[model samples]
Target: MKRILLACSSGMSTSLLVTKMQAYARSIGDEAEIWAVGQDKAKEGLKSADVVLIGPQMSFLKEELQKEAEPLQITVDVIDMMAYGMADGKRAYEQALSLMENK
Candidate 1:
């Protein structure tokens, strides 16, 4: 199973997206451990995550998060703005999978 982490300013904003992503994973019979956390908890969260998807509002943190993830060989990227605004979990989930595949 892949572990996907979503992070934002408060963590709460991305919780709904987590739900949607979970549903999509289930639909495809994909085993994934997906969760969300606030910026303060993100560095710690990265330790267990396979990939980190930052909320659009938290895009500024991507570079820092990427730095943290690089050493661990984990992918860190910003969620697409359009997908995030619409809570398009499939697209977001696909993005995470793509990142891992490319990595």
Candidate 2:
């Protein structure tokens, strides 16, 4: 199963997005482990993540996070602002899948 990690300033808003992404994954019969964590805990989560998506609020950390993830062969990206604000799970899931596919 693919492991997708979403990181935000506090993990609260991303938690809601996680639910939507999880539902979208289930609807399509995609076997993925999706979860959210605060930026402070992202490093620990990155150890097991296949893809790392930073929330728009934390997008500033993308470069740093990518550096940490690269050695692990993990794809890292910042969630699109509109998609994240609207809680568009399908889009978020697709974005994650696309990154992984291209990697």
Candidate 3:
């Protein structure tokens, strides 16, 4: 199973998106572990994450997060603005899978 983590300023903002992603995963019968965390906790989260998606609000932290994730061989990227704004779980899930695939 793949472990995908989403990070934001306080983590709370992404929780809803995580819920949506989880629903999408269940619909497709995917066993991926999807979760969210605050920026301060992202490094720790990266320890077990296969891919990390950053909320648009925290996009500036991507470089630093990537630095931490790179050592762990985890792909880090910012969620698409439109998809994120719309809370498009399917797009988010597909994006996460694509990153894992190309990592």
Instruction: Give the TM-score of each candidate.
Output: 0.97, 0.97, 0.96
Q: Better model by TM-score, 1 or 3? A: 1
lDDT at 103, model 2: 96
* Whole-structure CA lDDT of model 1: 0.93
User: Which residue pairs show backbone clashes in model 2?
Assistant: none
On the 0 to 100 scale, the lDDT of residue 36 in model 1 is: 98
What is every candidate's alpha-carbon RMSD to the true fold? 0.6, 0.6, 0.8
- Model 1 weakest 10-residue run by lDDT: 80-89
Across 44-98, the per-residue lDDT of candidate 2 in tens digits comes to 8999999999999887899999999999999889998877999999999999999
Candidates in order have lDDT scores of: 0.93, 0.93, 0.91
lDDT of 2: 0.93
Q: Which stretches of candidate 1 lie over 4 Å from their true place?
A: none
State the lDDT of candidate 3 residue by residue for 1-103, as single tens digits.
9899998899998888899999999999999899999989988999989999999988888898899888789999999887788888889999999999998
Inter-residue clash pairs, candidate 1: none
